[model samples]
Target: MVRAENLIVKAKCFIPIPPNPKNILSLKSTITSLMVDKGFEPENPTISGPTAGDAGVYYTFTACTTDPEGDNVRYQFDWGDGSVTTGWYASGTEVSLSHSWSSSGGYVVRVRARDVYGAWSGWSGLVVVIGEACPYVYAWNGSAYVLDNNVLVESEVSNGSDVEDFYKLEQAMAPYYAGDHFSVYSIMLGEFENEHSFIDMVRLYAVDHDSSVKIALTPDGQILTYSNPNPPVSAVDNYGYDWLSSLSEIDEIYYQGFPGDYLLLDFGSLDVSQAAKLVLRANLEWKKETCIHVQTLNETGEWEDAAILRTRNRWSTIIVDLADYLPNPEGTVKIRLYMTGVHKIDFVGLDTTVEQEYTITEATLFYAEHSESGKVTLKLLKSDDKYAELLPGEQIRLYFILPNKPADKNRSFIIQIEGHYYAIQ
Candidate 1:
């Protein structure tokens, strides 16, 4: 028999040469035949799924492929976020997979198939666009709605009750791209107040205007489109000797007092028609513990004590709520400070402590639309289930459960909600 080395050399020299020497097409066919004899790859995969979806929400996608040689096949997926499937699936099978994007953007999902011989086919890709989980938020920039990328609404705390120590939060909500209107589907509880805290009621309000507006809301739920914290239009004393003492807080030039001394202050025309609460503030001191009676002129032309101040020897500031005694058809409010025992007054003044500027009635659902002509029009809106359109320069307020007692100060919380914007043509 021939030597084994000679047989191996002869086998290596036997190449698959085409019968037609100058036929390029035949040569190509011969090469293709040799490749097929080794192994045939699977066909490229076809991907099918939703091309658009919300971020952080999962969606289903399907991929399918067939092998050219009818051999068993496997598939691998590229998720397009620098991630890929670690496992492979059977060939010629319609595989379904669910995936979610953590953020909003555009992504490309790709898949490829491989036969039993490990020959991978060309990759097939599908494009997907992910929208924000929350609605597109916009803020009224005094004229038009501008895109608000932050998608957060914030506010500062105010004293809820005039006498009791309680707090209320107020904020101006940004308008969302609802095309026309929107509805509150549900509220998703996130990092809000403490476990002990809860919302009592939710009040919704809206206003329509083509220009900017300066608006504020009081703790008692009154809307204010006018001036606030208005100081006494004029301050005067009974004696007229120390007229400016109550207006300015100066120690040396203060109004020295006797038992029956009184100071009168006049706060010019005020619109208390929609008044919720009014408060009076004064700066007083006493040589001995004394009493100062805060009196307001009622409609019957009689002076009544709205609040009483039991003073200590040192100078102290006092606030008296005067909600009940402030209705005057003439629109003028007069305050009198009657003293008992020895007392010294550094400053005496009157201010409107009504923090809320507007009120939205839950029953009738009234919204105040302010016109440039200093006119306010009451517009009726739908109930809590439905919300009115929020135009530019308008505002929206959310009411929560009032606290029973004062909690720790400087603490923080977050509020989250879920809703859908409608596109109405």
Candidate 2:
């Protein structure tokens, strides 16, 4: 229980030794309106700051509070690592403190505030973790977000979690038997980060069926690659029955075809606007003299031609950039594929690509499609010298940069891991 004059009595001894009578009177007056005398504690101080960092490296933590009675205030800190603050700090005007943990683990940071009368506020708390790794934190350094590291290691991910990160063919894949096509609007990798990191390799993975693949990457940073892929239906829109064809799938490949007969390839939503670049990709199969045509919807919602099949008699593929065709450049868009003749289409796919920025010394691009039958486990080296295992369908992406120069637009390769083969065009 506190009374106005009671504060004056409690505060008397704490006043400067042999305090001047006038000074003591002034202190008594101020105590009358102090936050503690009003029966209120300083609003519990708040802690807001990064939750992770590397040991022995300075990490800034923010502490904030307000005194209801508007008294001048100061703050005290408990670093949670057995470190003590020098003393109470002037906090009515501003507040923040920097600390470095001595070891790796989690810590609970506690802070509190005190009014001019020396009335202590309730403890405010925050939790932070320290790591033994070099890349300690990811944050903005005023002008840009920086990944703290001596040698930057880039990273990227896509597990068909969203079409914006990675796009695929129309939810329905029944039109032609061998050679069909689709397009994807991809964004520049740097857009996701504050800046761009060099690209090293492009990896692809698929399920069910494999054939010839061809790709063309245009200098415009538009991805033009080809492969015979039927991505999992799990990547389809989380909602909607608007499939590529009005007719139901008959065999996942065969469809009735005729002149002017068309099956739409829905790019759906690329989920990006104003992308600095595009990744136009597809999968197709063709026989001699048989052809298919592809088109994209523009910002104006108009369908326009994007590409034409050139499979000579044997099956061929084109996994390349369609620089001339930008789908839903202003928002989300879908592509349409028209059958120019009665031909059996084999495999067709569309994927979007974006570049990335690095934060560590090095990063390994990893991917696994979501499915009902099984799961894929991804592993990464952790700060504790142990491998960290990631559950299936968690993160799907590859982050890397070419060693000497920029990744060649004309570059191509094939990678195989865990009984799966990836043809990068």
Candidate 3:
């Protein structure tokens, strides 16, 4: 129950001295919208600054307020960790301050304003979130994604729940078997400066598969190579229909043949436009220097001799270059096998070699991670695209293609993969 002008009251008394009245001391009190007046107070200060910032970095904040009585005002800041009071400033003035946090977390910043008359305003608060200075990384395990620091990574090809090793090479060369020739390897990131670090912009290098019948690698980088051997989609022979199923099979069972008879093999759609080399691969059992004439149909639909195969008394692999016989490089390739004498045909297929980029009719590359929920497909990381993150307790799976079972018992092939990742701090 106070009026505006009578919010507070005060009194003053002066006492005179005998000798020096002019030096008399006086007690004074009054209400001139001053400390004794409780009706006027400064407005609540408002805080303005960043709501989120990195730890260990200094950030700026501003506080401002207005006083009702036109009195000078000063600001008090509760930085959440400590309190700071600033010098006096004119009413409606904005005061700026800077602060930093040592660790990462959320903090509540508060500010208040007080006038020279000793009237204070209510406090204003703001929330700020401090983040770490670096980003986090995670890796894909055979089962699930996990932190990179939780498991030990190996350097070789691994099987089962164990983390697959990095920088391991595996090769397969079996010309005698159907669908069993390929080389594969894997890449992983095991060494890092910090547990929370990650990498990106990875690239792979390698040589072509046709440089030699064996696997070879350059010193500068590992090689990525694959072979595509397609079997005849359909087969026709004047002799019998029972042996047509055996034309594409690699087992010991063969197609019994008659002298001077011919068998035609039709391989479905093929892409030889980018082929480094095209060859007809076949397995035949011959006796006594007997020969088979590899032929192709010409524009006139007549059988033309392509190559002569000569082998004796054993099962031998025959490789004939078909480059000169291709009529349409991107269309289906058909061939005829004409025997000069009685022989057995075990298997026949067309093998294509690629030097650089080539389209895959079927998926030869596969990536899988282990988890209680079974295997999951992860995004393929590329140099110019977004990369993957691996956290602790996680592992990477091996990259694999088609399996290889060599016709020659001593044949071995190897595929290698290298991963390069740059950690962002």
- By TM-score, who's the top model here? 3
TM-score of each: 0.28, 0.26, 0.30
Error of 1 at 327 (Å): 3.3
Better of 2 and 3 by lDDT: 3
lDDT of each: 0.44, 0.39, 0.50
Each model's RMSD to truth, in Å? 23.8, 21.5, 28.7
List candidate 2 stretches off by more than 4 Å.
4-38, 83-91, 132-425
lDDT of 1: 0.44
Model 3 misplaced stretches (Cα beyond 4 Å): 1-226, 240-244, 276-290, 328-332, 355-425
Q: Estimate the TM-score for candidate 3.
A: 0.30
lDDT of candidate 3 at residue 393, scale 0 to 100: 25
Worst 10 residues of 1 by lDDT: 189-198
Q: Mind giving the per-residue lDDT tens digits that candidate 3 earns over 11-80?
A: 5876655765444332223333333445677889888987657778999999999988788999998987
If candidate 2 were superposed on the true structure by all CA atoms, what would the RMSD be?
21.5
